[model samples]
Target: MDGRAFLASLRTTAVTRVEAGERVAQVSRNMGVSRSSVYEWLRQARSEPQKLQASPLQGRPSALSPDGLHDLATALLAGPESAGLTGRLWTRELVNELVSRDHGVSLTLTSIGRLLRSLGLWPRHSLVTWPDGSARLWKQRYAYIKEKAREQDALLMRGGLVDVGALLPRSSLPAAPFGFHLAYALIPGGPLLFRAYSGPANAATFLDFATGLVAETGRATCLITAPHPVFDLDECARGLAGLPLTVWVRSDGDARALRPAPAPATASAPDLRPAVLGGPSTGLWTMDRLAGHLSALFGHPVSTGEAEVLLSAQNLWPEGPLPPVLPPGSPAVGRWCHDVLPLFQAEAGPGAAVRFVQEVPLPGGRTLLLAVSPDQERRFAWYEEARYQGRMRATTLADFTRRLRQDLAEPLCLVVTDDSGWRSRDLDATATTVGDAFFCTWADGCGERVWRIPERDPVQALCRRHFHQGRGPAPAGTASLEMEHPPRGPVGTADRQVRIAAAREHARRQPLSAGGRLRELVLAGPPALLTTRTLTALLSRAYGRPVDADRAVAVLRDEGLWPEEFPSVEPGPWEHETLPLYLAHAGAGAAVRFVAEARLGGDLSLLVALDRAGETRFAWYPQARYRGRMRATTLVSFAGLLLDDANGPLCLVAADEAGWKSKELAAALARRPVLVVAAGVPYLCAWPAGCGNRAVMGDQCRTHARRSRRLAVHRARSGPLLDAVRAASAELAVARA
Candidate 1:
């Protein structure tokens, strides 16, 4: 029977035993099952006896056997290249082809998809890979340090250097900013220690702080800091020598996992209720006055509405109803209903000569003059005039008014304007010469007559709409008339020529293919890596149509822009040796650790050793150096340099990998008590207190492989789920509005 049938048979036996007068607890113990499970089986047998029976398996059998499926999964993990596919990505079609060629099983695309999902494989867009087992390493190192601190009865602290300029409030910043500050806090509810320094953080400043820390502690203390350059300098090492301090510099990933202690409570502000209620009864308490008073007391900006809420919470309301807040606009908008609108309506009779004018200053020393007539057959004219040195000439306005009168054939023009610049004597005289009346719209608070323009003037609204449409992309089969030639008047001949030349050049260029354009963009900029999703978006924008990512990849591949293989290094033979060694060295008692420079793909080149107590300590090079090349002399020099910082004996180990099979490396290590061994070494599993099995994969044994696969699937699905949730929240907010 299969695994599922075996479990069903076991459950049926348990229920049968319980029905034969056997105690549920005793049966559970005998069968190594929980009492709850035995009771549940009994209940199931009473209600649905068929559930306890091991029925024959249903459905069609899979085309591939178990070993065949395993081979396909291994091939998929090796990627599409192993199947002789031409592209890096694996679609259902590729997987189907691979299955047919390898196992002689011709499955449909849907079946291939089911097969891939069953093996826990999914499509990814980007090429970046994260190290596995980093979280496991972090937990192990953290627990080791905490145990060491507890045994020594030393005060444990966790902190690092920070840029004080970034953390301080704007009001507290000095006239000239200084950058670095050292801050450490005792863990599990202890006082914080902070020291600020001027200028950037350097070896000298760090050494000074270390001296002060030694003097202040005067006893054994364990301080954990992030791996920083200042701590590794020779000056810092000399200054910290023979001190009663044990400093541990953790990797960036591990250091970020440390949780900060809760901060002490800040002193509360003095109560302002007595001061506000005792006096200030001479006049009504306005919200604006209260807001200003509260802002001063709290030392931050506060609005009138916030002040009203605060006062209401304290059982203090304003004397009367608050004034309604006005909408943001020009001052003339307030008097539009009562002042100037009636005059315009009175003049809008049959054959009336009424015109609305709007003057807007634009960037690049230019002004837009727009005029519109309010009638069923509305007529409008606009002119863009370039001013010299930002000064508007009266002649430009005169010319626009003359053109409007001639175009509309209105003899007596009465124009309404809001700009105070219309009060120019030259403009008024020109208007009088043309039999036109230019009325200025300004509402003075007096018992006299006033004229003001409405907030949404017809001419200004039309001008804004026209400008916005002009900025957008033109529709297909449509062309702008102004592109061929510049508008008449004011613009110099040289400027007109330049505009025409630019338009001609833009028209002469032929459209490029999506692949060609994408290649150009990739070659032009810093984002050297482009995912399939990013490629689809870029190509769709370039071609003004939706382009599928698979199609884009095909086109780029045909053009030799994309490679057939994914950008990843194959797992080298040394990773198995390096990973276990690294984990072994990361245990409780090692005083210093060093990692050799070797090419161990998928993980950093790490070195691990065990002392007499069988405790492990680990050290590794930077993750970026996983694929980097280093000479034997370079490795030996670095190892010698790290020996200066070692508090106890140091040992180096060589693997059977190609990089470690060097005569020079072996000779150099022979000078020290280093061991160079080949394969067949029995190493413990990298899992936390894992089963005593030899590792077959990178660092995990076969027992924990299924658990690791489940965790990997969970990590893959979590990111997309979080992104979907955030998108839904934003969409909900927009819908509510």
Candidate 2:
């Protein structure tokens, strides 16, 4: 074969093989070529050049060929309405079903999609329906109306105003699928005004629209609309009754005004029209922009958000003057209400805005400015509770206020509290340090209260509770500092003894005081002993003071001497002595026993073992799992254990059954996560395992054991020697278990 012809044949074979999902290696073997050569030829065919098909062999066609299916789908989609179908769009399944039913052409759901793509009749899945009407129709109608208005030489200027009556739609917004109707009017220079009425729009809605319209333009004019019940005489009278603007309502055969008509203008009515005004029916967005436009029209900047607030206030008290909530003779506070009060209530909740005034220096020199809302008072209350009652340290109110003043860069004014506490004041205060006096209130409280003591310094501020004393109330005065008696002796042994006696007397007053009599009982006696000596001491000396049996028991439990079952042993000579002690306990019971070694002079080593009663024999290990597999060794001292290479070499070969069940690691570490329990008070600690020396996984684990020989006297007094022995015993138990 010629080289070019050979290459063309090879290319065809490679493409066929790839389509069959056969690997290059398999293809290479079948084609009698090296894998690399087959891959190279395939790559060349794909990237370098197109191969010529010898006979242009078209493979066996499907029952319905691609082109044939395309024609069928196109015919189906041309217009389902022609066939009296209700749906506007054709789904894949629908098209397939239609083709099969009409032409007896069966097509798979997947094949129908490919066929549709070929005909360019793809599905349009998402069609937005607007509050007023369908999005497409709205855009079309709006564009047409805007164009016609422009053609009539009526153009709205940036700052111009237009009295927008209502563009009442035939269908109620909510009744339709879209769920809202829009009312709007063209403003000359102001923003486009639109109000969304959820139900059918009528005269009341129109009146609302007109009132808002007048508030924006500072005057009202004739409202041109189509014949609708909203403009019936009664409805028109209701809407125009008390409005400041002269509402000349015009429709078919009905036109009237609140007052006598003015003389015909000397010239024709000024060409006042709108350019582009598009928004939802709520009119919130449109009104906001309109306010800004009004400001520009009048040569001053007006905030639409601000105008909305004022408009809301007017609506809230249509007939009455502004509310008298702000105290008399406080114009700064009153001015705060002009925009902020309504805004806060509308955005946050009712009764949420409270203004505060602070004197400040402006470009005009020293002046008093109102720092409206602040959360200090509420914050102070919380701080008081936590610091005194809850015994927690929290930031003070004064500090928070001072920081706020620094942050807002102004004397700091009003604050709005949205119900988050403590940190709320801090957040609000941060705004003031930047130098603008603004509104901010505590997160917990709804409104602001005037700063009672205006003075910043806590000390200089007069106490509201006791004005005559002329003092701040913080840390209220306590009992007299006067001593009943002087020191009994000079600074020597006698004085020290006196102090020690006094301390003991104070402790003896409370049965459950940390160093009191109850502690002594739990540390020294069993539960029965608690029923005897401890109870008697408590009843006689400190019964009326405070009783905490749990605390006392916890102390003993930490010492590994608490009675798991009551009626425990009395104190012995080795009560607090260190010894070569082996700790053994039954899993089902909480009692712990320490068996001392027979060897003398060597301080007792601490070792823990498991009880074998009913599967009670302790499975001992350095880890906290109860493993069945066991390994044993002799005990060693703390230093000796550390020095041993066998201990160092011990690593996780693999976990065993016994290792998984063992609780030794947990007990040895003395760490327990919080859990729910029944009956007993939560014993946060596990057994005699004290929260260990070092924390593991964010918790304390392992016992504290220290070895030092710095001072012989010190060494003799501390239980270090005993601790070493205990460590040795622990190592021995781990080895044996």
Candidate 3:
């Protein structure tokens, strides 16, 4: 070979020898080159292993043979629908299943996707966001509508009115979506005038359409409509300046006089033109949009997860005799007619939309097949009739299982309740036997067991076992079956009994009017707002027995726990302590004195004072000898019959100099003769009452504050400690002198 060939041959020989574990010395000797040459050859081979393996040999043969690829690509190009797939889109799992069935070789979704990509097929999707009145600046536009509705009604009532609006959905027509704003005018008794332009629902298009409609309608015409871009702006207003046309934008739900007809040009034989109001149906989408806007005005606004209880609930009240309960524009509250009721009664029933699709009928009634479905927002269950005042949310397993299957085709099994930790015995059930499928019940809320049914796919079967596998109940378990699976009476019976017992005892020990007691319960509560559930729960715990929420509300209302009306007069600013400090100084157990109205031989009702955030109580001044005490019963009525006419209102004065507000407190005290001695000081008050609901003194959490005095000094003073000190000082001084 030539020199290049010889060098290449030598390098190959050296690299092969080195890689074969031959010593560098042996490789160099065999190749007739230096040891350095062998090392260099090996290093090149190691640096670029790909180059060493870069022979024209085939890599692992394609998973599919040439024929298989040809056939597979053909099948895919035909589209998923042609292959009998349920969904329009070709998902990876579907593709995998299809390929496995056709080729008799299972391929993962990932691999099939790669094969499809090589065959030049790709996936496409459609995405959309719904457009509505709730677009940007909705609040501003809504406000504008509310303000201008009256003017629009006047214009519409005049004669020739042009109403403009965009059609329901965007279309794929040349203009493509955000359909044209159409200005249609039905002149009373005259020819119908209409104009349509394809484009965005914007100010420019609106102005153009309005101009065209005005031209067709002639000089004297009025256009009234919901506020849109062109109509609401100054530019459109300027465009109509020269014309005899007036534009009025309607406000939300503005009540306006009916538009009277204008005389036709000749009234020649009925002008057989199409009437816009009596035209073909705008279809469900348009009606849905109408319902949405109307509902907002009627208080059944479009919000996610709200239930449809009645037509008033959805605000789809049509043109008919309005339901007796519905008041004009307002939807009826807490009541609805059945005709307009929603398929989902969750909002009406206070639970959520649930489906008990599969049913088995018996002479008794029907039984429901349940499968656990996870939902984040609502609690759904299948039951027949709601139990007494029973919350739709709260249901027994028996009831849920007994609901007659409403829809038949569903094959899903119901999974029990979720992670509230507070489980209802009825909602939480045991492993039940229903047909071939075990209605499995497991206590662990963390694991969700769905699709555990016998899987045809081995891979799917393995996954089923992996996810649903969990520990079963013990053969010798000591779990509380009685609590978990209670016999049918009512739910929460034990809880109610405990609560009733506790509450009755507390009420007997400390009596207050029913309403007052409930108010106190509400005021002293930890939660900021009281819901029936929370209140009922609270009442149950406080008293012994079941606390029905509706009953509690009724009791509170009856008690006239109404706020006291403050006298039109405002309290003048004077020395005063708020709740905390007031509770401290001149508080309970503090020395107090009541001053008399008359300077000489007057009646002084000295009493111990009690105050709360809402109300105050007074008792005989502690250690008042024989003075009578005041009771909580007459707290508001206990105004001083005599000394009440104060320089201002009788002030709550502190006896201690530290606690007292000013010299006014002392001067006022000196004016009266009764003296109170407490902790070596005296607090004085004329005991004015009926100022506010504060009597309305609270105790429970706030109603949490209860009165008690500070800790007392316990140490005894030495009899002669002061005298002994003085004598010692004198003796020491004399000795020093």
**lDDT tens digits by residue: candidate 2, 77-136:** 233444455443334565666777765788887787565433322222211211243556
Q: Is candidate 1 or candidate 2 better by lDDT?
A: 1
| Deviation (Å) of 58 in candidate 2 | 69
The regions of model 1 sitting more than 4 angstroms off are 1-517, 540-551, 564-697, 700-737
For candidate 3, the per-residue lDDT at 103 reads 72
Tens digits of lDDT, candidate 3, 1-737: 12233345446655765777877764553333556756766777888644433244357756766446545544443435566754333445767767777777788766865675443232111111113344445556545644554454422311121221111111111111211223444444543333223222333334444555554444455554544433433333444554455655544543122221221222222221121112123211122343364355445453211111122222222212111111111111101111011111212233433321222221222222223221111112222433334333345444443331232233223322221211445454322111111111121111112235333321111113323453333233111111122222332322222222222222322222321334344444222323346656666544323458566545443443221221121122321324223334333433222221111112222222322222322222212222333222222122232133222223333222221322443454555532222221212221233122232112112121232111111112443687789999999999999
**Model 2 reaches what TM-score against the true structure?**
0.15
Best by lDDT: 1
- Angstrom error of the Cα, residue 175, model 3: value is 37
Cα lDDT, all candidates: 0.44, 0.33, 0.33
Candidate 3 residue spans exceeding 4 A from truth = 1-359, 362-367, 370-396, 399-572, 575-581, 585-737
Rank order by lDDT, top first? 1, 3, 2
lDDT for 461 (candidate 1): 14
- lDDT value, residue 473 of candidate 1: 32
